[model samples]
Target: MRQLILLCSLPLLVGCATTKTGLAPEDVSAASAKGDDVIWTDAASVEAQCNAALEAGRAVRDTIVRESASDQDVIRGFDNLSLAIDETYGWTQLMFSVHPDKVIREAAQGCEKSLSKFLNDVSLDRALYEAAGGVDGEQLEGLAKRVHEHQMRDFRRSGVSKNEETRARLAELHAEMVELGQSFQKNVLADVRSVKITDAGRLNGLPQDFIDAHAPDDDGTITLTTNYPDFFPIQTYAQDSALRKDLYEQFMQRAYPANGEVLLSLLKKRHEYATLLGYPSWAAYVTEDKMIGSAEATDAFIGQIASIARPRMEADLKLLLKRKQQDDPKADAIQVWDRFYYVGKVREADFGFDSRTVRPYFPYEQVRTGILDLYGELFGLRFVQDKDADVWHESVEAFDVYTGEQHVARFFLDMHPREGKYQHAAMFPIQTGLEDGRMPIAALVCNFPDPSKGDGKALMEHKQVVTYFHEFGHLIHHLLATRGDYVKLAGINVEWDFVEAPSQILEEWAWDTDVLQRFAKHVDTGEPIPAEMVKKMRDAEEFGLGANVMRQVFYTAYSFYLHHRDPTSLVLDDYTDEIFRDFSPYPRFDGSYVYANFGHLIGYSAIYYTYQWSLAISKDLFTRFQSAGLLDPVVAKHYRESILEPGGTRDAADLVRTFLERESNLDAYKKWLTE
Candidate 1:
């Protein structure tokens, strides 16, 4: 709930914006939205449709297997069936709107049921598995092996190995887990919609747009939500310590609604689900498909970093505390809210750098081109802007990315903030490739401030630039993936720990002055970024690096612990406190339910540690570029061919080794923590 959706007014394109749903402003204006159940009768009717779709798909697969059809025919069959399933899942995702529609629920449940039945059908499974894995090494080729492995792993994970009764229970558990996850998300969203701020003076040092957006009608005071743009900046810069404390408590207290009972129940249910699957804990059950594969390794990695970070973070906290005493006489020990504020101040003081001044050189359009230029030099890819695109939002701009004469992939840049949309920057894969002519389309979504205001220059902060590059890295990964004939195996479908490495690696380019000067130009003035300022930014990069790395390690370690620990012996609150207690700069409060606010743990389950694990790989990968030139095409092509193009076809560990000429080690990450 600390990251509530940030609503910003996006600049308009030439025409009216329309989403794939065709539910534009005009459509909504004329019709009252239908209820969940209004679209479909009950779960039974939805179930019938799902069954029919599955039956049709199965018949197609049977034909392919029986006839020993070529890969082309198999691809065509998959395309048609995948289209239908995609349509079904699209509606399934839309069910969690403000108004509940039972049709969405019914359809989702029905589809899950159908999928379960399909996976458990032994004859068909053996046929598909054999076909995908291949006989005499003549079956699925290239990325197909990756897709086959992913499918096989999923089948095993879903209790396909269990008896009939256990299989049935597995489906039930899946349905219940889905329901619980949805409920948990909705409850947190609902509980922390907006916090009331009665005093207007508390808004001192905040941006004007933030105040304008959050100010209540007929009141002088401004309110705030959990959105990163509003929350993080305020938490870091707000002068009023009381307001900061209030916001911090409100954010932290989001998880333990009803005194942690809800989260505890959910955790227990998760434990039951894992135990039912013949696993020791939820962590073990989920990790088999992930790169880390075990809690012991993940915890050990965290511990190694912690040993280095503990002293550094403590020293940094002491410095901040000493500063706080001079800045505000009444200040106690530095709290959660004060962390960002002091860090921001220390950064400016240490490096003589100001984010606002650096912003002038990084206009939104310039930053976009800068990212494209860096990749272009490295990968020999050209991004030509596509004027005629069926874009979902007006702020979205499309580009057709090409490698030499080959049309490799397309990209959409939705790089502005808007209401009712996801707040943080993320990459959404529109169309993933298989063996067929199905190419990939990826969108880079961000919440950067609109450029059309008084400034007319949409300058971006340094941190914002890093986020922009990070999300685009995901876009490149999705678009460049030449995976086999399965939708699930394409692009970001690699092991969760490995997926972030590609994105994290790109962040290093943002820090490099050579790359920044190429595209970082003043919007109105059109002047290049000064060398001295660039030097300062680089010098400041290592500031608070220890605390930052520790924060990531803490979150990652805590997530793995939550999944692996015994629920009976360690309650949800206790488990959270125990894992994260030593890592945080501030003291933990009783009944802290930070897990409730963590959407990653919900979406990724035990795989949240993958970020840190991937960071290790990314660090190792970045070091190669540091040794070689950052934009060296020879190295870039190696990355493209070995990592990006293969997608999840081969094992992620193999991909890392092939690219680096050795196994990925944690030494770079450990060294980074000490810095």
Candidate 2:
């Protein structure tokens, strides 16, 4: 969420702005608003579509296997087969996620296992597997070759060559894993709880804007949910320490005691799956295809970073202790709830600045416009609003991306959190670009405070603004590329550890003073944030780097322990609490099962180290921009072509080498650690 550096300048060939309504006359005529059912339907309909896709895929495979087909024909058949099943599944999952209806989501879930099992069966088909392996990847070039190569590896990894008994077990394991992940995610999303606070006077340090935004009930109590926009302000600024503790505990225990069992089951299955695949652990299996190459490597990297981060964290803890003592003579320890509150106090005292002062300068619309425009200016891309396209929600918007006159990609922006919405910020790819005139589409889902809750415009905190930049980088990574094969070179198909680099790189833009001035403006006065305040903001960002780094280290370690250790012997609370005592400044709260709600256990698995690992790469890449200039089109284009466009066509390390014209070093990363 923090750390960025920049330099340079560029020329703009195209400059255009969209209407606030984001619709033109033609768009209005053609535009059809959509609801949840537009993409999501009953289980029967979804089952039928999945069956058709499976049937169609096999027919393509059968034709290739039976006919004396040329290389071109064989490649086309595979592409067609993949498109049928993949696009259908992608559509269903996307719809199910954004749809508000519980029935639709349940239907999607009901069909997921059956459909996935069928597809995995096809992936393990010996005829198709041999056909793919027989193709010479070097002879075919681009998408065709890459697709063949990837398919061959995938077929082997799917255990297509295994005996019937073992293969069946593998398939069962795959299906069970998918269900566990789905159930865990569902539990998190369905969890809705709010705490009602009655004492209005107790909200002393909180901004009036926050208090007014959440209207009190007839009994004069305000309800607080775990949404970032609403929750974070109170965590940071509220005077009532007890209330903050209550909220933090609830937030930590989300998806809860139930999910703890779910998580353990998942870990056990993952370990068994890895053992079946001839690996020591799931961490090793997952990292085999990533930059680090093994669990041992990742562990070493974590240790290297932790060594740098620990001392800085100790200093931060000392500073917090000093501040706590000032507030109370008897105060001796800093708890998790007290961390942000004291950090806020230190910023006010040290910098004479408040985050609220900066928030007014960044009205959501203007900030978004600025971010998009900045990207367009540097990247040679233009975005045309497709306001009339069918979307899951009214607040969701669509835009087609272009390079000159040719449409390159399209993306959806679901920028606000709502009831039954996906809570975390992420980029979800709908369709990735292929060489055969097919364009890519992606979604950027986030939970920025909805401006409509209070005013029609949201004033974003600097951190939230950074999250926008980060997530947009991901969308750009997904939308801006084409590969020889749709499945192989499509956006974000790269190694998980390196995939975060693009988005992480753009977060620097948020920290850029020149960039901030371009879009950050006061909703009331139209004045940009002062340069002096910008410097203060930048300086204040390093206030507690140690504590934050320690937290990440713990998360990374905790995940590793679950996947690599003996799950039967490991107790989740005991493992996490001990780690907290060792690395964290605060004592662990009793009965808190933070790991249960940690979505990474479901999605990221043992790959949480990627966040820190990618940050190193991001910092290295940012240094390239720092030297060449942040706005340098030559540098930006180099990044786009070398890093973004390659997708997964080349090794991630090779891509970095090509862009940097040298091997990436951790000097930039280590420097940032202590800074």
lDDT by residue (212-256, candidate 2, tens digit) is: 887778988888987677668878988888888888887777888
lDDT of 1 at 509: 86
Among these predictions, the greatest lDDT belongs to 2
Q: Where does candidate 2 stray beyond 4 Å?
A: 1-52, 67-77, 99-118, 133-146, 179-204, 207-234, 240-243, 246-261, 387-396, 416-420, 447-455
lDDT of 1 by residue, 150-178 (tens): 54555566566567787677667766777
The runs of at least 3 residues in candidate 1 whose Cα sits more than 4 Å from the true structure, single-residue gaps closed, are: 1-58, 61-150, 193-202, 207-230, 328-332, 390-395, 418-420, 434-438, 450-456, 483-488, 590-592
Prediction 2 TM-score vs. true: 0.83
User: lDDT of each prediction vs. the true structure?
Assistant: 0.64, 0.73
Task: State in Å the error of residue 194, model 2.
Answer: 8.2
